[model samples]
Target: MKDIRIGIIGFGTVGSGLAKTLYEQKDRLRQKTGANLTLARVADISITSLPKEYSDVVLSNDANDIFNDPEIDIVVELIGGMEPARTFMLTAIAKGKHVVTANKALLSIHGKEIFDAAVKNNVEVGYEASVGGGIPIIKALKEGLVANRINYIKGIMNGTANYILSQMTDRGLPFAEVLKKAQELGFAEADPTYDVEGIDTAHKLAILMTIAYGLDVRLDDINVEGISSIEPIDIEYARKFGYRIKLLAISRNHGDNIEARVHPTMVPENHMLASINGAFNGILINGDTVGDVLLYGAGAGMMPTGSAVAADVVDISRNILAGAINRVPALSYLPEHIGKPRITPMTDLVCPFYFRVTALDKPGVLSIITGIFGKHGISIRSMIQPGQDAGEPVHIVFRTHRAAEAAVKNAIKEIDALEICSAPTVKIRILNPE
Candidate 1:
């Protein structure tokens, strides 16, 4: 069998997991692929906690050792950042080595540059572990769903946000409380801005949209909204109206345009995505011929992410053994064939909305609110106003039919200026049926 030497750059949670997988499953992988995959070297700043089984493998503090090594056929990058990871991967490709990475942020921002380098060097870049963890959604889009024209993709791409929302819904806890608990449970980072604020989901969404739509979509094009604004009252109102609230990353192909956004969405109760609770991730993809398909699994962790990285290694190894370089384009479309579609602005988005307003329980308050909606051409589908004492502010929730986002924003501004209103009105967009 032809030997395919592998070098790993980081020995953190995922890198350690990859090393362990390669050490334990070497015989099985060789038997299945007829390739002798070897874990030749690992480079980390510190290797004190390196697993006992990998002690025999070469270790170095400088990543350039792996990048410059002549025997290494593939370089797996588990370092999660933009600076050194990007530089290392570029150097690896420049050295004519296949690259496998789990760095979503790096890929989302610098993918085009890195892919161009790989093409110039006549090498393949595998990033299946960059998005969806262990879901295999990338491979599915590249190979399995290649025959169909994808129409849309919606996913709960951030597990930390999902876990926080799941706890808030199940326990009726507020966002802060649930986030604190999530941090204690190691599901959320100490600095939770990326996960809670929807930036992490935007990174993953950019990758998926690029592959599915054959476009060069960037993170800047995605309209992002966080789950920090979601409240217990909104969750209660959503449940009362046969819907569940989830942080959804949505993208749709609109002929000459594309719609890509990440925000808190109200999904119908019976939908499969609504049932995907806790720290799990679910993706619903709509293709012209395949109709709809759902991919669900653990979106993060050591082994789950490691499995994806290992799969990428095996795939690249197969290509090496067959002497086929650049078998599949990085984005599943030929570089010249990829089109640049205009991104639809949030102001022009047309969708139903759920609104919660705190206002004084006066006779003319409802009339004024309804009049404002009518002025904006936003028709109400349904509303709930629980009986309250005449002098105190009460919660009034309304569900509106499809309307332009600009119109809704105008109405909200006008409504908030009213003297009878107590707090800023909250709005959550509702997802249309698949």
Candidate 2:
């Protein structure tokens, strides 16, 4: 119940922003919570990198300084990686110090071990910043919406991917062109594989799955498909069909099993998520009682992510003052309740699909392809030959009724192998969660 001393690791953009929040609002926070919060020490590879305004705070090149400090009640980790961030968090837990982290990749991969250690050591772990930056989606899932049974979670969780896709959709630009533009504007990293390939979204989805379903879900459990494969023409055809394309991270709870996937989805333009464009995040959560709710905001940034970390700090600090250890379980479920669920394989997933097949535009070419779909038990709901189906190279667009994933892929394989096929089929999942 005394003053809760805080130590911060990784003095980068997010780290400095936390220091600012604590420094600027120190008095206001203490007055409201009736708990003294101190920004005691900060550690990084180069302490000098921290600005002069933070010179009064203790600076250390070695994180062990904070890990070993007995008075520090909480450790805020802002380092965004799999290495020292994971080790630092573990050490903090081992030392019986509460932890707050924004390292989604590390948590998604090694969270079980870190959380197990926290439970054994009797310390709290706050990871509100891991998924939605400043959106507070983590808290909402774990606490705010605790009473409602979650039906599904679909989100545009990655800003860089969303921005790229939005640019491609709005300007009729190619993926590469939009990607380069995103990088130039500092919205994306130079190496944007994780962002473009849906790896980052998968990581976040894994964490959300764990929280929502009480499952020990791993990143690999989710089926991942990136937006880099999306072509401008595909976007054009999607718009023609009254839809817009966005990279969506999705999960659905099916009583006994769960569906987890991250891919470029054809969302109806009328849906709330389709309107979420640019460097923004929109998470559409459907609960049995709540019906529908959308959490939208800046998905990632120095200030936005830092705000999330600070929120965790406040949450953990309140727990410390209450002397109620583990007042809320880290992943929203009690330790004994946490277990893995059967992940519905991608092949077993049933959804409407969009396919753009390029063929030789010869007679009977259409029948061969339709025959393959029939063989796979997929029925076409709509078809468009675009300009002419009788050209040297044909671009045929088709939308199908709800069909199995295995059936669609099998049909695509057969269609692509034919001599009349001009290019590999462009396949995208359609979002029709009605």
Best by TM-score: 1
How far residue 69's Cα lies from its native spot in candidate 1, in Å, is: 1.1
- The digit string of per-residue lDDT tens for model 2 on 1-434 reads 46889999988888888888888888888887788788888888865656677666789889999999999999999888988788899999998999999888998889999999999999999888889888999999989989888889999999999999999989999989999989999999999999999999999999999998899999878889998899999999999999999999999999899999999999998999999999999999999998999999989988888888888888888887778888888888998999887999899889999999998877788889998999999999999995664568879899999999999988999899998998999999999667
List clashing residue pairs in candidate 1: none
Name the regions of candidate 2 deviating beyond 4 angstroms: 47-49, 388-391
lDDT of each: 0.92, 0.90
How many residue pairs clash in model 1? 0
Maximum-lDDT candidate: 1
Question: Can you list the residue pairs that collide in candidate 2?
Answer: none
